[model samples]
Structure formats: C-alpha cells, structure tokens
Target: MRARLDAESRAAGFVSTGVCRPDAVPDIAAHLSTFVDAGRHGQMAWMAERMAWRGDPAALWPEARSVVMLAHSYAPQHDPLSDLDRREQGAISVYAQGRDYHDVVKKALKRVARWMVAEAGCEVKVFVDTAPVMEKPLAQAAGLGWQGKHTNLLSRKFGNWVFLGAIFTTLELEVDAPEAEHCGSCRKCLDICPTDAFPAPFQLDARRCISYLTIEHRGPVDADLRPALGNRIYGCDDCLAVCPWNKFAVEASDMRYHGPHRAPDLADLAQLDDAGFRARFSGSPIKRIGRDRMVRNVCYAIGNSGAAHLKPVVQDLCEDDDATVADAARWAVERL
Candidate 1:
C-alpha cells in the first residue's frame, strides 16, 4: 500500500512522499506554545487562534490512522539571490513568481487523495498550507526532511524549495524513519537576514522579518527597517537562498512557476492601479496582498532603489487613497 501510494504521489507531480502516524509530532504543542508566547509570530493572530488543530493532527481528525506527507519542489534554475543587485527592479520571492502554490498544490493533493481512496479503499482528507496542520514536523517525522536552522524543512533530495501537502487516511501504512537534522555548524541562513529576524538558531521573530512586513503585516512598517528592505517588494527569500543544502535542488518541473515576474521593474510596479494590479497578478500569489499593500511594498523598494528616475512615481503616490501606501510613498520620496 505504501509503495503504491508513493508511485501515485510521484505521478501526481510531487517529488517526494512519506507516511507517519497522525500523532507522530509529539513536541509540536510545546514548541508552538513557546514560539507564540514569545510573540514570535508577530501579527499573525491566526496562529494563536488555531493552536489545538495546528499543534496536534490527531486532534484535528481523530478518525485518521496515518498522515501521508508530500513535497513538490519549485527550485529555480538560476541563483534566487541574483535579483538583489538589480536595485531598479523589485525582487519578488521565487515562490510567488508564477501561479499561486495554494491552487497548484491543492489540485495535486486532490489527485493523490482520490488515488489512495480508489486503490486502497480508505477514507481520506487532503490539506495544503491553508489548514492548521503542522506540516513541517509531520514531514520530518515521515522522513521527508528535517527542519533546518531557518525553521523551514530541508531535504537532501529536494532542498528548501518544496511545497508541502498532506493526506490523512484511515488506512495504516508502513511509516518511514524520521530524517535526522544535518545543519551541523552552519549559520549561513541566520547571517543572511537583513533585519536579524532570528533570535537564535531555529527560531524566528516575524515582526522583523521582511516577508511578514511586506505580506502579512498591515499598516505602516517601521521607518528604520524600511531601509533594510532593499529592492524586495514582495516576500523575502534571503534565508532560503543562502542555505547550503540548496546545492542539491533541481529546476522546477512546473514551467508555469518560472519567468520574468521574478524581478519586475520597481517604477512600473509603482504605477499599477487596483484593476491593473489584479489583471497583472491574476493567477499569482502576489494578488493576495491587494493593490494597496503591494503598492506600499513597491514604494519601500523604490526608496531603497536610490534611483532618482523613480522620484516622480514615488511623489505621485504620496497622495494615494490608502494611508499606508501614501506613507510609504512619502518615505520613498524623502529617501530619493
């Protein structure tokens, strides 16, 4: 049953798959409590709201006997950090460069779950990152990979550029041994962060994280941290890009996930209205941030760009309807 499931998962476009009991993540509750209690999650109040389900998969679905974890790699062929040097361009994270992973990964999860049900005669439920399930720990427990010092899963086979999905089923399958941590003495990921978001190894303070500031965070960002944002207008991938384990990563099989959107011109992005923003990022994850938030990010990047040519664009945005966007634009104009 396990072997058949593995083959089905690969056919469904997942690069790696493994299984573990629903109750496999024993220390997740404690770890989560510590992280949240320390206010490390920043303004992501949803994490605190779903504490029970997020920490314990068994609690989420008591009927489930096993959890099958799957990983879909989206590694880039070129250097992910190379865009940082192009100060006039806005650096969007590699993950959001193409179609939204939520839509893509969810479709693949449904395919795998349907196969498991038809072949093994078992009831199943599929989950992507949208759910409160602790996917990384479950993946590590299933031998998919270990959580590196950056706190993201890292696999010898797929590196740090994989999207995780899961299938919970009533059928008990043979479980694989957990992958042991291989970070050793490496602190490359920790050192590369522009904002020093990491309080220590394997922990993150999301308040200072560029990804959180540009994406999940609402309202005005701190003036001091805005300068460090550089040209990254969307999510930041500094830690992930600097990881030594990424040497084993392969180019993504999904062609839709690779292209010029990786580094859009900051000036061009600054001129987008609400409708234009929607049309430009129709199928992309960047759409989730909405026009105002995205413009706010672009303004920050423009400020960091130091390109006098973008001063007019920034000055025009200073009268934006959205207060946050206007604030960011004013900040950018001052910098220019």
Candidate 2:
C-alpha cells in the first residue's frame, strides 16, 4: 500500500512522498508554543487561534491512521537572488512568480487523495497549506527532509523550493524513517537575512521578516526596517536562496512557475490600480496581498531602490485610499 501510494504520488507530479503516523510529530506542540509565546509569528494571529489543530494532527482528525506527505519542487531556473541587483525592478519571491501553489498543489492533492480512496478503499482528507496542519514537522517525520536552520524543509533530492501537501487516511500504511539533519555547521541561511529575523538557529521572528512585512503584515511597516527591504516588493527568499543545500535543487517542472514575473518593473507595478493589480496577478499568489498591500510593498521597494526616476510614480500614490499605501508612497517620495 505504501509503495503504491508513493508511485501514485510521483505519477501525479509530486517529486517527493513519504508516510508517517498521524501522531508522528511528537514535539510539535511544545515547539509551536515556544515560537508563538515568543511572539515570533508576528501578526499571523490565525496561528494562535487554532492551537489544538495546528499543534497536533491526531487532534485534527482522530480517525486518521496515517499521514502521507508530498513535496512538489518549484526551484528557480536562474539565481533567485540575481534580481536584487536590478534596483529598478521589484523582486517578487520565486514561489509567487507563477500560479498560486495552493490552487496548483490542492488540485494535485485531490487527485492523489481520490486515488488513495479508490485503490485502498480507505477514507481520506487532503490538505495543502491552508489547513491548520503543521506540514514541516510531518514532512520531516515522513523522511521528506529535515527542517533546516531557516526553519523550512530541505531535502537532499529537492532542496527548500518544494511545496508540501498531505493526505490523511484511515489505512495503516508503513511509515518511513525520518530524515536526519544535514545542516552541519552551515549558517549561510541565517546570515543572509537583511533584517536579522532569526533569533537563533532554526527559529524566526516573523515581525522582522521581509516576507511577513510585505505579505501578512498589515498597516505601516517600521521606517527603519523599510530601508532593508531593498527591491523585494513581495516575499523575500534570501535565506532559501543562500542555503548550501540548494546546490542539488532542480529547475521547476511546472512551466507556469517560470518567467519574468520574478522581477517586474517597479514603475509598472506602482501604476497598477485595484483592477489592474487583480488582472496582472490573476492566477498568482501575489494577488492575495490585494492592491493596497501590493502597492505598499512596491512603494517600500521604490524607496529602497534610490532611483529618482520612480519618484513621480510614488508621488502619484501619495493619496492612496489605504492609509498604509499612502504612508508608504509618502515615505518613498521622501526617500527618492
């Protein structure tokens, strides 16, 4: 059953697959409590809201006997950090460069889940990031990879550029041995962070993280932190890009995830109204930030770019309906 499920997962485009008991993540609850108690999750209050479900998968679904974890690689074809030098362009994270992974990975998860139900005659539930499940620890427990010092899963086969999805089933499948940590003495992921978001190895302070500030964070970002944002207008991938394990990373198999969307021109992005923003990032994950938040991030990038040519573009947004956007535009104009 385990072998068949693995084969089905690979046939469905997932690059990695493994199984573990639903109760495999023994230390997750304690680790999560420590992280959240330290206020590391920042404004992601949702993490604190569903304490039981997020901390324990068994608690989430008691009927589940096993959890099958799957990983889909979305590694960049070129250097993910190369766009930081193009100050005039806005650096969007590699993950959001194409169609939203939730939609893509969810569809793939459903396909695999349906197959599991059909082949094994077992009940199943699929989850792809949106759920309260702690996928990293489950993935680690399932031998997909160890959670690296950056706190993201890194596999010898696929590195840190993979999207995780899971299938919980009533079938008692054999579990795989968990992957051991291979980070050794490497601190490259920790050192590369512009805002020093990591308090120590394998921990993150999301409030200072560029990805959180630009995406999940609401309202005005700290003026001091804004300068360090550089040209990254969306999510930041500094830690992921600098990881030594990425040497083994493969190019994304999904063609939709490849392209110039990796670095869009700040000028063009700054001019986007609500409708234009929706149309531009229609199927992309960047759309989730909405126009105001997206433009706010662009303004921060414009300010950091030091490109005088974009001053007028920022000025035009000075009176944006969203206070955050307006504040960001004013800040950009002052900086430019």
lDDT for 195 (candidate 2)? 100
Model 1: ten consecutive residues of lowest lDDT? 251-260
- Model 2 clash tally, residue pairs: 0
Model 1, 1-336: lDDT tens digits are: 778888888888899999999989889999999999999898899999999998889998899999999999899877878999999998889989988988889999999888888888899999998889999999999999999998999988878999999999999899999999999999999999999999899888999999999999999999999999999989999999998888888667577778558999888889999999999999998998999999999999999888998899999999999999999999999999
What is candidate 2's TM-score against the reference?
A: 0.98
Backbone clash count for every predicted candidate, in the order shown: 0, 0
Q: How far is 103's C-alpha from truth in model 1 (Å)?
A: 1.5
Q: List the residue pairs that clash in candidate 1.
A: none
Measured over all alpha carbons after superposition, the RMSD of each candidate to the real structure, in angstroms, is 1.0, 1.0
